[model samples]
Structures are given as structure tokens and as C-alpha cells.
Target: MITEPARGSTVTQTIDNDTADMSDVEAGAFADYVPSSELQKVLTEAVSLLGGSERPGQVAMAAAVEQSLRSDGKLAVQAGTGTGKSLGYLLPALLYCLHEDARVVISTATLALQNQIITKDAPLAVEAVKNVTDSELRVEVLKGWQNYVCLHKLNGGYEGSEDDLFSTMEDSLAPGAGGGGEAASGRGTKTARQMRGFAAETKKLYEWARETTTGDRDEAPRGISARAWRQVSLSSLECVGEKCPFRSECFQVSARDKAAQAQVVVTNHAMIGLEAAGKQNPLPPCEAIIVDEAHELDERVRSQASTEFSANMLATCAKAAGNLGVSGSEELSQQAIMLGVALQNLEDSRLTQMPEAVAECRTLALPPLKAALTELSAKSGSDAGSDGEKHADAAKTAVAKAALTSLLDTLETMTPESVANGETILWLSRGRDGDQEPRLYTAPLDVAGKLANRLWSEHAIIATSATLKLGGTFAPLIHKMGLQLEEPQPETLDVGSPFRHDRQGILYLARDLPAPTRGEHPEVFWDRLVELVEASGGGALGLFSSRKMAERAGEVLRERTDLSIMVQGEDSMAALVNDMREDTSACLMGTLSLWQGVDLPGNTCRLVLIDRIPFPVPSDPVIEARCAAVKRAGGSDFMEVSLTHAALLLAQGTGRLLRSAADRGVVAVLDSRLATARYGGFLRASLPPLWPTEDAQVVLDALRRLHQKVS
Candidate 1:
């Protein structure tokens, strides 16, 4: 068994080739590996399909993938913008899988990437690879159950008084912008089919999906609601596996089984976190795991492993338990009632606060659960009970006891001193799914520790992503994932970018601009923004860190110019993309959703506007705890980690400027920190090598010149 190294002991290798030691690695170990000319042809085809030219970064990514497969040692490659990093990695991964017959799992940060891979990129790459590889490589996309619509929940409807609640939801969703029953566009154009019974539609599609060759969600002609998807979904902890009535034909199970049989599997970070934590074993063990948009891995892991208890969930569980036969008996049933009432009383009292409620819930909950378990155990062992009766009694007792004990233990471990001074939380809540039950719970700020301990320790794991590096190095990132660097120096390489950032784009910082106050409107910034947009001639993307900010900016732009302004939350992401693509002189103002994963080459997005540096909220429980934890551990959490995390995200944000060698644009960041702060240099270094300037006119002129060239 391999033991994890002591914290802060691992060192990351410098990007330069000046000091790397070649003694440990064989010089020609990968000499037999040659870049497939056929794979190169496919990449060329992809570039042509997008009407863009390939850059150096894309070429290097392709090379790195080819080499990493042969060596099998861990490899991290940073491919800057226009690298076609997705296709770069895809080409080699496909070629190698075909040759070695090894399964490969490709994981990404967002649903957008997963969609692209399953719907667009994967198919395109496969079509190109098929011409040369002489073998068909099977690929599939697997997501958490909650992402799919549930046939049972949709058809059966909800159990309680959800009829009225669901009726309101249905009515609200019925009419779109154009007075149509379907989700309509501004012009009254409906984007999809009319609403149907969620369970029936979900199950029908799921059944049809089984018979179809590709199980991609994009195959569905109409869009589905996120809320509707949650009804039929099951997470790792909630899944009962083979015992499920739909086990033989389960969509999730079939997806996993197919992944095991296929050569390549496309999945997301949350599922990967579960896989890394050994929570659910879906895909077969593979030689490598490729993580796309890798920067979000830490946060994604935290989200999946963390537990959330609402006042509602607790109340529902209490009510559900009461309805169960456990409370049908005389004495134990009375104890169960007392237990539920006490829990509810606590929830109603000073326990409205999450921390206090978590503490009190543990105290009130354990004793009753223990008493009920004792009673149930006694009944199960009685001579008067039949075999089936005994089994049922025992099963109920075991589940209640196990769940109560686990929750109690978790709450007890989450002390204010531990959480407030660290990066974890023990949250208490008061709400359930369309019911009035409340629950109490605790969760961790980071799931890397759990994941590393449970899965990576015993497995030869491969985690890959495009935007993993934040501050020129991977040190800040690996720490969040609960993995330390190996030896005094860990391997590092920048295969170099295919796109010429210095030539294709410029980075403009809005220095001397006043910081935004809480109540301020866009009027203060709109004058300068209009001038910039006019200079760019409307081919721009304004990215705001907040949705409120994005909407305000959109309002101002709408009032100021003839340019088309499409803001997020105004419509679906698909609608926004379509609008941006149709009009060359259009501006798309959006929040974090458009920060990364947006791909538009040439004139469509010639100017990128960053409203602010995306920073984790100071009052956020997880971020606050993590910062304090770093401080307690004898480190400066702000400068050492948090800022670095922000820088990486900023890099990802700025990278949206250029997607091909011929793609030219100016990335304008409203935050002065990219120019003024002492740490500004650090953030700038993380971005592509763009020519930095503070002159607004210069940036405007550049945008004009670029737009003219494209037009």
C-alpha cells in the first residue's frame, strides 16, 4: 500500500527545460511512439470545419497525449487558447485506445463540455479517426441520475400535497415570452415540444435511448427542466443498486455497463470525484483519466461529497418514519412520536441557526433512534414473529440505526472551532422536497481528502483538464484535491500554445476606474462601455462575475446602442448562443456561465469584457473556513491559495478571447487589479502572453482594426 506524503513537502518542476533532470526517465522510452499522420489529418479537418486555423498549443497537446499514453507516468500539460486542446487530447486518446485496447475516461468541469463531447466533439473526432484507425471506438456519456428526468416521479406525481405546488409550476412554465404554451422566444417562436407528463416522457426517452446507438441527451428534440430532472435521479448514497425494480433496464446502470465495454467514456468531475472516492464504481479501471477544464475539480469534489440537511428533509424523514410500521406498535410508536416532536421543537427554537440546530439535533435525535432500534430488535428476535416478519423488522431497525448514527457522528465532529477556524461546515436546515419537514446536517468545504484517501490511494489514477493551472504551477490545485506532489520536484511542462496571443489579441486593463458600490447602477460605467462597444462594432462578450451586474450592464447596453444585447437568464444558454452567432454586431452580457466553455472564433466575439475578477465570496462558509484553516496551519491563506485560485479562474475567463490562430480580439478587464494591485503581476502571468495596455483608445483602435479585417 502506498502512503501519502507529508503536506507541503512536494515540489513542482519549473516550466523551463533549463533545470529538468533526465536521469530518472529513459530518453527513448517513447521513441517508438510516432504521431499518427491520420490523426493530424482529422485535426486539420476540425480546424476547417470551424473555419479556423490550428495554433501551436493544439499541436503540442496532441503530442503530449501521444507521449503520455506510452509512458504511463502521470503527465500535466497546459495548452493555452486556440490549442484546440479538446481535439488535441481526443485524437491521441482515440488512437491509443484503438491500438492498446485500453479503456479511457474523459472527465470535464462543466455540463457544456460534457455536452460538446457527447454531442459535437466526440462525434466529429470519431468520424475523423475512423478514416485512419481502421477500428470503431465506442464512446458514451454518463451523468448523475438526477440530471435525467425520472419516469416514476413524473408519472406517479408527488406523494404529498404537491398537486397545488406542481400546478403553479406547470402554469408558470406553460407560457413563454410569446404567449405560447411551449418555452417561446422573444418572437413567439417555441424552441421545443409542449410539456408532457415528466415521468412518461423521461421513461419513454430512456427506453428509446436503450434501443438507440448513442445515449446522448442532445438527441432529445426538446429541452428539459433541471427541477424536473431531479425527480427521478439518485445519487451515490441514495442508490440501492441491483435491488431496484428497474435494475435490469436501469439507464444509469446500462450507461455504466456500456462505459465498461467501450474504449472511451465521457463524464463530469462530480462523478469522477465519486469514482476517485470509490463511492460508486461505474467505469472499469483504466490507465488514464483525462480531466477537461480541470481548474474546477476541487470545488466540484467539495460539492459532491458535502452533505446538506434542510429543516424540510428532517421533517419529512420524521413524518415518513412515523408512517412506517415502526410506529404502528404501541410502546415504541409512542417513543417514535416523542422523538419526532422533540426534533421539530428543536428546529423551531434557537436552532434556526444552522450550527446550533446541528448540535441540538444530534442530542435530540440519537436517544429516540436508539430506543426504537432496541424495541425493533427485540420484536425481530421474538418467538411469535414469522421469518419474513423478523427480517422486515430487522431491516427497518438497521436502516434507521445506521442513518441516525452516521448523522449524529458527523454533527458531533463538526465543531464551530473546527469549522469556523477551518474549511468545513456543519449546516442545519428546515425544509424538504415540496413538504414542510426540516433536517439538520454537516458538510466539508473540500472533498479532496476523502477522495484521495478512498480512491486514488489504491488506484493508478489519471486526472486531466485544460484549465488546471492557476499561477504558472499546479501546486495550488493539487493541494485542494488532497494530493501532494511527489519527491522534491514534480514533473511539469507547457507544450506551448498553438495560438499566438501576443499577435492575435491584446489585454486591456481599466486603470483608475472607480470600484463598484452595492447600490450603483450601470450608468456610471455605461458611457465608457458604449464607446468601447462602438469601437469593437458590437462583436463582443461582456462577462460579469454576478448575474445582477450582468443584467444591469445589459440594460445599459440596450438603451445606449443599436447592438443586440442578449443577457443570461433572459433565455436558455442555447438561445443566447444562437443569438450571438446570428448577429455579428451583437453583444452578449452574461455572468459566470459564460466565463468559460464559450467557443466562438473569428469576428463573432472580437472583444471580450470582464466585469470583475471572479472571487469566492468572503462570507461563504466553505471559503472562509478554508482561509482560516490555512492561517492556523501557519500560512497566508489569502495570498498563498485563495488569490491563486482566483488567478486560475481569471486565466480561464480571459482565454475566451482567441480560439484559432486567425481569431483576433482584445480582452478588456474592468478590474484595475490586473494593472494596479501588487499581485496583479501574478494574475497577468497566468494569462496568455498578450500585450498589456491601460490606454482605452489603443484597445478601441485594435478592436476596430481586427473587426475590419474579419469583415
Candidate 2:
């Protein structure tokens, strides 16, 4: 572990927060205006209100965060489950924003946590602050523009010709419509069924927009299904900001206004990545940042930095031509047809499969498409004055122009060699459900350098997550985040889990089981799973390595056992979890996603079955390339990257077992490698300190006892 430079003065260690000795905070306390005692007072009151006694770990985290933000230094905190990490970070962040009259941004990895912070934690903290300091603290949540309702799209979409929008093009060179079927163009068939479904969904969205207090797509009755939502929402490429009649009530603008006025802004990781990458956005600038799920930061940044161009874009260009009714419409339409056909044919020749071919397509088709777009642009210009009750024809033309120009700009950047480079991940993916050509994609091989340059260097960042350190060291994360091991290094602390893991959890490795060969779950494994579930009496969460394994096990379990088996995709995620919680005898099985962000306390999940070690697919181009780079740098990619990744996942999967003090369970790793393989000890260190056992009967008996006690 790399130690930070010594502060001029030491943090006075003392007993504070009434019940706990916050040694972690006092270890390197902030030398700022607010005293540690004062900070602790506010945090203690907030914790009491949020329904927990004072936790030493939480207090220490709050102090470390306060020090980093006020001093403009970076800090990495690993606050384990039951540490009350959210309130610890938020209370201090809110107070700092209020004191300095500056905005502080809090970023999470998902919408669920973003909403939770704004709706649940933020409000409580605001009230807590008011109670303690008699001051007001305001918070607002911000998402990307596309997440909001676009009144322009709502009013202008389908205005030109509903029939034309879904018509099958007659051009033989174009990639014909797939109509959402299993065909060459999966979404080629844009027929009545497709059109009607879109119309119905849009109508509902339109009605909701008028009445909704918050025009967030995630809040709609029907969640934002990409295909359905795209019909009514506008990407930045399609939006004519502040130009339409609905400008005053524009959801995006209003959301931005609210965020600007806020002292503390709650947002997702994507927004942070975008801002760091130098993309202009509506989110407020911050004095300090608190990244809650910081472990995923580098990956999220890489994903955001990635840009792709697909053939479905040709449809947008073609629609723009039809909508404008311009003089060059015929020429633009022909170019669109030619480009789509060329892209699809190139893909068929395995252009993306081989790196060399992806580079060549740039020479063959890119220049011609750009020339056609320039000619089309010269033929038509925006009509600013446009209004209508039935159809916004003039506005449609302006939008079409914007969409076409954007497409042209995107394709212009992908050079043949640049598209197929060691630093880029290139692939071929089919376009959306419609008459669309497959898209050629190139994303960054890794985000470490970009994030290190863009985010960590500029802001006083507070990176916090339960699983930031694999095997209890922040070295991997620090390196990946582009931080150094030398002086001025980020301060670090690992406030361990508050739960009594030694008593509350049991670690059972099924050593008798065979090795997982070629990532396949054997029939014997399924039989053992059945036996375990039967013994546990169905408070089991069967987490598998693949969807096929989950589905197969689910089917066999349903046939072999009488317990209600709920599998993912069988119903909505929320619905399935709710159903499982409502019934104690229900066993829910799913893939990788279930490993984290699950909160099934008490008897909802008394046993967790890990079918195999969670490792990245060896064939994934990105992973392979990342490993190659590590090896070239004189590092063991398997240990640093692969082992670390699997360990973090195992830690996350096991963390689900002991969610609360009252919760107790068995984390059974069915693969024998975790017990027999050389890497088993390293992996075991990632999990909680549970009572280890190898006897199958011992685990079965314990499960039976737990089930009996719960019942």
C-alpha cells in the first residue's frame, strides 16, 4: 500500500459520535474551517435520524471525505456493507456545498441508486441539516437530455407521412427491412404491427408528458424500452434546442434549470465521464465530487468515450431527405441506399471480424457518403418559423437536416487504420428493428489514461465503493484510475463490514464437485443444486455464469422440485424480486447482474449458489486486448486483471449474503477450483470472513436448521 505524504499536523485522535471511537478520521483529519468535532456532530445527528447508531467506519469516512474536498486532495474510501456510507458521504458533502456556496456533484453508476440518493437519502439529510444548523440545502438529479421527453419530437414525429416513415424502400442496394424478425435485417419489416405498437406507446408517452411532474423516461409507466422510446425522444443530434414552440416547457431545459439552482447535484457516472471527456453538458460544475460506485468508474468512462456508427443511420438520413422535400432529396436517397448496401455487404465478408478489413471500408464508402451529405446540405436550410396543429412540416425539415449532418460528421472520423488499431475495439453489430444495415463500431481498449487525465487530475475526487480493493489493497484500482504509487497519492482507508461475518455467514466450497470445463455447468452440478435447494427449503439465489445455465437449471428445478422458481426475464426485475420477497419458499435464479445491488435480507436469501468462478470470456476482444497490453507492460494480466476481476465479483456475490445484522446464510461455491486450484486462496480472501467448511452434509444440515428457524 502506498502511503500519502505526511500532513503538517496530525489529526487529534479522540472518542466522538458518543458511541464510537472514530480513529480512521482522526488518522488524517482535515485541517480546514470546520473542526472534526463539528463535522461529527452533524453526521451523528444525521445517522441517528437515518435509523442507525453511530458507526466508527461511517464517521471516519465522513471525516476523510471532508478533508479531501476542503483541501483539494483526492481520497479513496472502501466502506463495506452496513457502514451507512451514503449518509456519511452525503451529510458532509451537503454541508460543504452550503458553507462554501458552491455546488458538489454526487455520481452513482445506475439510475436506481441516483433516484435513491435524490429521493430517499438527500431529503432526509436536508431535513437533518435543517434541524442541526437551521439552514436550507437543495439537491437536484440530472440525467442526459435523451432521458427527458422531447416535445418537439412528440409534435413533429409522424407529421410528414406516417405511411412513408414505415414504408419498405424499393432500392435494391439498400439493406431491406427485417421487420423485427429473424432475417438479414432483423428490424427490416416496418409494418402495421411495428407501426401500431410504436404509435400506441408514443400516445401514452405524450399523455404522460402533459401530466407528469417529472418527465423522466425512467419514471414513465412503461419504462424506456429503447425502440419504443426512440420514437418520442431526441438525441442531441436531433434536438433543435430552444427553437421549437415548446421551448418554455421543454423538459430538458427545465431539468437543467433545476440542477443549476441546486447546491448539491445527484447524477449518474455517464454524465461525469462526458464532462471529463470535454463534451458540453447541462450538469452544473462542481467544487468537489463524490463518486459512490467508483470501482466501475474507469469502465463507465471508457464506455462513454466510445463512439459508433451503424447503418440504421442511413434510415435517419433517408427520412430527413423525404421530410425536407428538397431538390437534392433524390441524390441523398441514392447515397443512403448505396452506403447501407455497401456496409451490409462488407460485414458479410467478415469485415469487422478481421481488423484489416474494417480499416478498408473507410476508403471504399466514407468519402462518397460525405460528398453526398454536402450536396444535400447545400440544397436545404432550417425554417425557423414553423407551427401546426396536425403536422409540423417546416420543423420536420429542419430536424432532418440536423440528423443528416450529424450522421455525416460521425462517419467522417473513422479512418481505415484508426478503426482497426491496437488501442480500439472494433466489432460488427446489427442495427435496430427496422430496415437498417449492421453498424461498424470502434471503442477505446481501456479508459485508464483518459480518466486519469480528465477526471482525477482536475477535481477533488472522493472515490468510494465496498469492493474497490481486491484482497484488501487499493493498488489495482489506483493504477487503473491512473493514480501513481508515489507522493501526493490519494489517501486510503478500508472500513470493514459491520456485520458479524464470523457468526452470521458460512463459506461452503463444494470440493467434491467437478471442475467447470469450457464454462459449462455439468448435470451433476444441477443435481447438487437441487439437493442444496431442497435442504435449504428455497431461500436460495442461484447465480450462474450464463443465461443458458440459469434457464436450464430453472427448468430442471421446476420439474424436479415443488418450490416456486422465479428466473430473470420471466417477469420484470422489480416484479420478480417483489414476488420472491413476498414468498419465503421462492428460489430466484439469474445471471451476473444478480451478483450485486441485491438487498434480499432475512429469509429471502439464506443460501447463495455460485455455479462457477465469474471470469470474463476469454474470447472478448476488449478483455483479450487488455490482457495483451498488461503482458506487454511486464505484468501478469491473469493475476492483476483476471484474478482481481473475479475476486471483486465473488466479493460482491458473497456480500449479498450478509446484508444486515440479522441476516445469516451460506455462500456455496459449487466449482471445486475455488478449493483445489492454486488461485483459490487468493479468491477466498476476497469474500467475507465466514466459517469455512467442505462437508456437503454439514452445509445441508445448517441450511435445514436455518429454514426451520425462519419458518
Candidate 3:
């Protein structure tokens, strides 16, 4: 650890010192030693490869490798952009893996980062390690099933043909229909004509891909479509695992097998969450895990755990159940009645205000659920027909049982404990359109305590992100993770970016603007947004806090600008980004999805406009309970919990700007609170250190200069 000269600071530490020709440090204690001159040479090579100068993040990571290895304790590093963080952690983990002959799992926040590591950084880092020493180490990328195309689905074709579905699917798969099959020009720019011309070529290539067995899409980035990917992707509910006929040829399994043999495994956040949640534990217990772009983990976990019931899902399940034609059909119908009865009881207008009936249903729900599971178990075991037919019947019955059981369990969990400090609320919501079936939503009062207990209790963990520490401390966020220690010894480090933020970037706010009511000032907001986009000559990304707002704002802007506008729901996220990149003057208006994973550098994106700070939905059961819990604990929920979450998201949203040192952009926050509220300082502190400006002309001038340079 090197210390800079300041008012009263004096420190003695080695920056880069070669300790020895070859040495072995304890797997957990590697961070204790200063990098010898020999190690410095290795660091220099990595830095050069990544096109970054040595910075605090790099230095801290080198040190953390030693500390995280030696103590086997957790470390939270806040490495900003342009810090070469990917290499900062990767290089150290690589060295530790080689020395200890142990495997390392590196989890990142996005597929883009995972792909970059597998395709670019890991290969180069492997070579860098080899240059430093002749040690041989293997590295591989691991992703979920959806990342690869299902050859069976593409070639063997699916069952049923209601809407010329097979023909439509085939045509889409055919090189250029843009129907949602894989594309050769994964760049997402191929027009319909070009796609058609290339369909045959893509089919031939896909056939070859099936035989190769790597099945990892990162190996071939462009051939898979969003639709095809959905069919192949596996969630906890859908993965038949060993039961799938394709088990032997399973791409997910094959990827895990490769990872099992490799010293370093590159993967994404959700997969890591799955492992941490004890869902996907495929690889050998890793000795160390490096998290790149660690800031996005919480949101990723929330999304992965979120469950929404819809009419489509209900109707599909019902039809699939109905398709079982059997003598026991009446009994099956009765079992379905249990679900309907429970929902109907809650909906009865006469019982709607009755507290006792609602309480009784909540109380008796668990027993019926258990009985249903037992009955369903017996039915599944009884053979209905041929082996395949029986299997299908059993699967359908089991799915129904599981869904019902989950509903009951969720409800049970949502009930507040007597004498509990906080309240738990239940919400019933109907699907879109008047006729869609209604659904129930149940959420726990708080997830932080549960998250911390699950992640930190039994395992040696490291949680790193660009904005983990807000207001110069991490207590609030750490508490949310359920870390409870008087003095949690988790190592904390910040790698501030090397970007010329003070000179190249500015933060603009509509402070004088009135707060936006739910339905008011939308037009005014859109008008201001259009003016900013025009002044910047397009090349902007508009981030809305909600999907409704994003769509509404997008609609308003579309009529006002000649620049192409791509909204989130209109197309796949990948397609939108690809389009945004291709059109220099295009404006991509999207909800929170564009906030973090997006990466557009240089003049391709010079302005980022945000509609508001993304606060969690107020009606959200989990968030509401968490806030209430904080209040019950005699703390301000807004300051302790809600604000912390918002600050982290705000940091992520603003992070879209200035991706690299050479990148320059204006980050415009339409939310005036960012410029007016007292807690605004906390949010501002969380952002990348940038010059603050309220003058619109100054921002316009900077955009003009950037536009001129690009032109």
C-alpha cells in the first residue's frame, strides 16, 4: 500500500518490489506481501494490455490478493471505471490459482464483461502469467443454458403447429428473417434482405456448432437470437436436469464440466447468485472468487428472485393439466379447486372486510398445501401409461404441486410474527386487461438479514462494487447484506477513475423545475429532454425510472426529434443497444435496464439523460416491509435503507457515462431532488468524481465541442 504526500502523512510501503524468482504464499494470505520487482513487471504487462495507468485500484487489488488469500476474510473493493479493475482482480486471482493449485470463480455483473474476459482478458492474462512463470493454468467461461442455442429445438423442431409456428420459427432461424433466430451478423444491424441472403449460411454454421460440444455462445457471439435463447435458457423451475433427454448433450453441463477442469472460471452475476443461494453448485468449491463490476449484484439478485404470476402462465398450466385426459380428471379438477377456492375466498366482497375470515384462510392455507403436495406425490408415482407418457404426467402434476406449495409458503412467510416490530402486507393484483386472472403477491419484510445470513455465515465471501461505500462508509449497505459485527474487518478500498471527469464531464440538474407529480409535467419533461438531445446532436441515452414513464416519454420525444428513437419494450435490449450504436444521432429511451450494463464510449454516446432517481416501487411488498422494519427499529427507513439503495442505483445510472478515459459526456439528471435535497450530497458523493455545473450553456458548449471533434 503506497501513501501519497499530504499535510501530515508519512508512510513506508513498497509499490512494486520483486520478492523472489518463484515463491508460494498461503492460499488465503497472499495479500500481505508487497509485490516484488518481478511481480511489478507482470503488473506492468497487464496494465499495458488493458491500456490503463497504475492506480489505487490496481495497487489495492494486488494487496487484497495477499490479504484475501492469507486471512480468508471478506474484502469489498470499490474500483471505479478506467481503473483496469478486470485485470486488477483477475491477475491476482490467476497468480493465487497457480500458486495454490486451486480454482477461482470470477463473477461479473454483465454478459458483456463475462464475454470480454473469456474472449479477451483471460486469454491475455493467461499468457501474462505464463510469461512471469512457466506454470500451466486453464481458464474457461461458464454461462447458463439460455446463452447457447438448442440444436434440437432448431433442427428437430418443436411439437405442435398452431400458428404455422414451425415454419415461422424456421424462417426466423433462416439467416435473415429477423424472426428471433440466431444471426450471423450478431451486430444486430442486418436488414431483412441481408438476413434472408445469409440464412442458409447460418444454418450450416449452427449445425457445425452443435457438433463441437463447447456450446458456449461466447465462443460465437452473433448466431443466437433472443427468442431461441429464451427457449434454451434454464431457470430453477424449468431445468429438468438429469430428466431431460438431452442431458447427455446438455450445454450447461458441458460448460460446467469444462469449468470443473479449469483453474479460473468466468461467469455472470445471476449464476453467482444461484450458487450463493445454493441453487447452482456445479463447480468444485472455489478457493477464491473475484467479482468484477461488483456494484450490480443486488439488483441482479432481486430480479432473479422476483416472481410474478400472470394469466398466460396460469392458462398454459391449466391447458397442460387438462391435456392429461384421464379417469382421475375429476380429482385433478378438485385439486385445482383448492387454488381457486383460496383466491375466491379472498375476493368475496362479503368477506372482503372480514378480518377473521382472512386470518383463518392465512392460518389454514399451509395444511391444505401440504396435503396437496402429498396427494400429488402419490399420483406422480402411479404409472398412467408408457414410460414417456408417465413421465410427462408426473412432471405436470409435480409442477402444479410445486407452484401451489410455493404460493402457500410465500404467504406463510409474508405473515408478520406476533410481537414482531414490523408489519407484513399482502397484495392481490390482476393481470393486464380486464379479463386476465388475478394473482397474489407475498414478500418478506426484509431481505438484507436473510441475504447476509445465507451468503456470509458459512462461506468466505467477497462483495465488491463501484458504489458499495456511500457517504465515505459502508455500514448501511453492509447492514443490508445482514453483516452484523461491531467492527466488520472486511477490507475496504476505492480505485477512483483516471478519467478527466473534472475537465471532460459535467452534471446538470433541473433544480428550478417543479417536482413531477404522477401525471403532471410529463410534456414539459419531454420537451426539456428533446431540447437537450438536440443541443447535444443526439447520441444520447434516456433512462427512466419506470417502464410506464419510459414509454410515455419515448412517445413524446418520437414526434419531436428526427433522430431515431428506440424504446425498451419495442425490441430486445441487445437490439436496442446495437441500433443506438449504429445511429450516431439516435436516442435510445429505456427504463432502468439501460442504466448499468450499457457501454457506449467516444462520440457514439455523449449525453446521458435520466428522468429520476430509481427508487424501489412503493407498493412493492418486500421494499415496503423493509422500510417499515427500519422504522420499527427506531431508524429512518428512508435514510438507512431506501436512500442507500437509491444511491447505489443512481451511481450505476451515472456510471454509464465516461466508460473510458478518452470518453467524454454530459450526465443530465431530470430529477430536481438530486440538486436540491439534503441527502442529495450522499448521492452525489456516490457518483464518479466529476465537475458539477448548473449552467446549461456550459454543457451545450461542451457537447458542441465533442460533436465538432466527432464530425
TM-score of 1: 0.74
- Candidate 2 lDDT over residue span 549-602, tens digit each: 889889989999999998988988888888999998999999988988878987
Per-prediction CA RMSD (Å): 10.6, 7.3, 9.8
Error of 3 at 675 (Å): 2.6
Task: Tell me the tens digit of each residue's lDDT in model 1 across 314-390.
Answer: 33334434544454224333433554454565532212134553445545655654554455455435544764444
- Between candidates 1 and 2, name the one with more favorable TM-score: 2
How do the residues 400-499 of candidate 3 rate in per-residue lDDT, one tens digit apiece?
5545544444545545352143433345554334233444553334444445655555444566666777766777666655544423556665545555
Task: Tell me, by TM-score, which candidate is best.
Answer: 2
TM-score, structure 2 vs. true: 0.85
Q: Local error of candidate 1 at 148, Å?
A: 4.1
lDDT of each: 0.61, 0.71, 0.61
| Model 1 segments more than 4 A misplaced | 1-59, 91-101, 119-135, 148-223, 231-247, 327-357, 366-423, 427-442, 459-463, 487-490, 515-524, 707-711
Cα deviation at 519, candidate 2, in Å, is 6.4
TM-scores of the candidates in the order shown: 0.74, 0.85, 0.75
Evaluate model 2: give its lDDT: 0.71
Give the distance in Å from residue 597's predicted Cα in candidate 2 to where it truly belongs.
Answer: 1.7
**Candidate 2 ranges with C-alpha deviation above 4 Å:** 1-35, 156-158, 161-200, 318-394, 405-409, 430-437, 485-487
